[model samples]
Target: MKRFLVAGALASTLLLAGCASGTGGLTTGSVDSISAVEPGMDSGMVTAEGLKTNADGSVASDASGSVSTDVSRSVIKTASVSVAVDHPLEVAPELATIAANAGGYVQDSSNSPASEYQSESIYVTLRIPADKFDAATAEVLALGTFVSSSQSESDVTLQVTDVDARIASLTTSVDRLTALMANATNTADLLAAESALAQRQAELDSLVSQRDYLSNQVDLATLSVSVIATTDAAPTSQSFWDGLSQGWSALVNAGSVFVVALGFLLPWLAILAVIAFAALVIIWLSIRASRRRHESSTPEE
Candidate 1:
């Protein structure tokens, strides 16, 4: 527990505080350029018709009107929570509700039977909004004793920016390809332009889908919560032999006490010993006299 506290303190001091930093956003590429590529020129043009690549090094008079934009990266927010509750079955749902009320949802749950010396344990993963993560954790701790907990935040800002930039660049490529395909007089040129346009369009679609996924991750922070409940087990009763063993143990203990008392009464022990010896001697003499009298009478008869 002390180790956990120390780690937590260090993390708090060293880790970044905010979900975002410096208007923290995805990294993005700058617009490279927008230039007209003539039929004989080796340049690229993004236009409304289709993607256009020049055969040679010349600029088309109409290519000057188009502009270029770069895609940016996406940033994601993440965290985790783990705790052992005294009553998992009873407390887990309640805790889940608390988390829900705090703008979180249970992601998953696990359960196991009671072990030889422990109660049933249940674990649940709770995902909450980034802003409510702290409150959610506190409410869970209130459900029962806290065994352990931890939290972390990762910077996906650069990744997000990169995906966005890719999407923008692809979208621009698709537009240019479409423009060139429309203007092509040769079937070969038209086919090549259409193929390029399709490729760029597909890439754009993929990037946009990636962007949406990243957006969701950033919007919702994920936390994993685990709960364990203490359960009552059947008590084991002592058997007949067990009772006998206990009785013997008590007798042995009493004998030890008696020996100890004798040690403390050494003077009294000597007096008791002398008295017992005198009593035995008196009984012996009386028996001997009786026997002698009976024998004397028999001889006279």
Candidate 2:
């Protein structure tokens, strides 16, 4: 009987311990469930298991492994390139075609014809998709001699994250306000909820606009290209009218240079004139004094 009681007591103790462990696990799971659905969590924070949305509003899993972490980075890219081409006008059209093929567009362009003295040149600004920036730039660079190139990037990740957070918070606020308005009992409560909703909606709209603008800057890479014709590409001959126009322009330019030179020399010329006048006056006074001395020495003749 003593053995039986001891065995029973041991079994009861084990049973109690198992029960306690199960209870603890249940409590922990309940807490986790509550936290998972808790309000005000920043859903914009990308995590290893985080899913991203497609443009069509469909949920998609990240397949690029660690690349998803960089998805949140908002970088604005821009480039300025100076290239020497044999024909700038010809290159301008080719550049436009290249941009079009790259799913880009020419934002602005200026093509100047080759003159008798000046070489033909073109300035074009393109807006290409960020994904195609490198390829587009490479193609553009290959179109002509690479004179110089520079690129710039700005990280707006923090700003984008902040705006997203604010937008989410405001969206929650608006939803709450809308719910309150729906459940409002009195006129005063209804009016107040409406006013709050309006205010929150306005703020949400502004933040969304800002986010969109930032997104556009990240999505489109701006590239400014300057194509200059080489000296060898200059026109070798000119018609009579072309010669006359060139001569006229040269004359005008020469006159402008002459005026500028005269303006620069005017001050020096004035100083020299003053010095010369002073020297002349001194010489004249000296001669007059010498004559007087000679007369005096000549005994008042």
Best by TM-score: 2
What lDDT is reached at residue 53 by model 1?
Answer: 29
Error of 2 at 279 (Å): 37
Query: Residue-wise lDDT of candidate 1 within 139-170, one digit each (tens)?
Result: 87777655666766666655565465456545
User: Total clashes, candidate 1?
Assistant: 34
Q: TM-score for model 2? A: 0.55
Least lDDT summed over 10 consecutive residues: which range in candidate 1? 13-22
- Report the C-alpha lDDT of model 2 over 121-218, residue by residue, as the tens digit: 99999999999999999999999777889999988766676566657655665666676666656676667667656655775777788889989889
TM-scores of the models, in the order given: 0.49, 0.55
- Best model number under lDDT: 2
- What are the candidates' C-alpha RMSDs? 23.3, 16.3
